[model samples]
Target chain A: TQLLEQSPQFLSIQEGENLTVYCNSSSVFSSLQWYRQEPGEGPVLLVTVVTGGEVKKLKRLTFQFGDARKDSSLHITAAQPGDTGLYLCAGGPHKTGANSKLTFGKGITLSVRP
Target chain B: EAGVAQSPRYKIIEKRQSVAFWCNPISGHATLYWYQQILGQGPKLLIQFQNNGVVDDSQLPKDRFSAERLKGVDSTLKIQPAKLEDSAVYLCASNRLRDARSEYFGPGTRLTVL
Candidate 1:
């Protein structure tokens, strides 16, 4: 079973619309990260939330870490065609060393039409 | 700075054939990772390397898969007697350090085994 679960396996919307993708897990994590991958390319880091209850914004994209550190969410405002891609969530468990392994969610494919 | 570099952006092979993929991480990055991404799913970590030493490879199929990093720099992943189920995108990623929040990824090599 996947350690992290992402909802809305696929989403297609028109430009200027808003959307939210979620990542949920039963186990608490030390940190959570979100990435975006375009077709035929590798994923690109969008944001990382290390502390629970923390929220970060990157222009049109907003990321939040759950208070319990077991979940996270990504919200896109006024979506643009450029935002079209697959979104993935990854988490790191609490560990002593820096060499921690990451668990990934299945991901959500977002297609924004212009 | 250059992002992670991968070779042979695409490869097609028949079952039981062997193939290899190469990666060169960003300069000064000490942590390298190889991920396998099947269609409609997130990328899964296959192995991780710290410099030229292995740190994690629990998910790698040792019988048919082998990887090595030489001189703490470039790395290679090989699959022998490839299986049809092994068809996926082989992604190479790098981080400045193990604890670093973001990992830079290459375009990835798409492998199709028939």
Candidate 2:
């Protein structure tokens, strides 16, 4: 089974600090997506990277898909208390049909203290 | 446009009891998904539906877990004789048929099986 592994499962930093979270896997994916989930809510999509080595930016968050398509990363610039949440990375399979599914990482919990 | 909607924000029940959760996807979305997310983990897909037809349910525990999307709009998930490990946040998500890469998720239903 394909799996996505996230690093630094827990992180704490002061506001205005920069942090990077990594997601790695042995299997390649057609696309990768990043999501941020707050307490009492489901995850909200942050960005999606389809091509290898692709990068997408949304406000203070930047997401990068690895060149091999087997890994991805999310970097937060000048983190704020509002940005504290669980960050997740999900990978979509390359193939179509019933086997086509998305695999999610365990996620990294980030706490930005003001 | 309205996002996905789920009922019963929280439910607490003893083990072996039965429980059900309901979800209403955004209007006009053809694909809907149900996911189970244990604490400290990313959401795992339990089932997927495309216009009331089951697309994938490989991960769902067929013995005690069942879900259905009757009218291709709203769906229900039921767990009979739940176990303690069944406690988790149940999330519902949906996306258009043409764009499977991006998904919109609803605030999940939190279930606690004591």
List iRMS for all predictions: 1.1, 2.2
Which CAPRI quality tier does the interface of model 1 achieve? Answer: high
Native contacts retained per candidate? 0.83, 0.70
Which candidate leads in lDDT?
A: 1
lDDT of candidate 1? 0.93
lDDT of 2 by residue, A63-114 (tens): 9999999999999999999999999999887776434457899999999999
How do the residues A1-114 of candidate 1 rate in per-residue lDDT, one tens digit apiece? 339999889999999999999999998888899999999999999998999999999999999999999999999999999999999999986765746678889899999998
List lDDT for all candidates, in order: 0.93, 0.92
What are the per-residue Cα lDDT tens digits for candidate 1 across B1-114?
Answer: 999999989999999999999999999999999999999999999999999999999999999999999899999999998999999999999998887767889999999999
Comparing only chain B with the true structure, the TM-scores of all models are: 0.99, 0.97
- Scoring only the A-chain of each prediction against the true A-chain gives TM-scores of 0.95, 0.96
Candidate 2 residue pairs in clash (backbone atoms < 3 Å): none
Model 1 sits at an interface RMSD, in angstroms, of 1.1
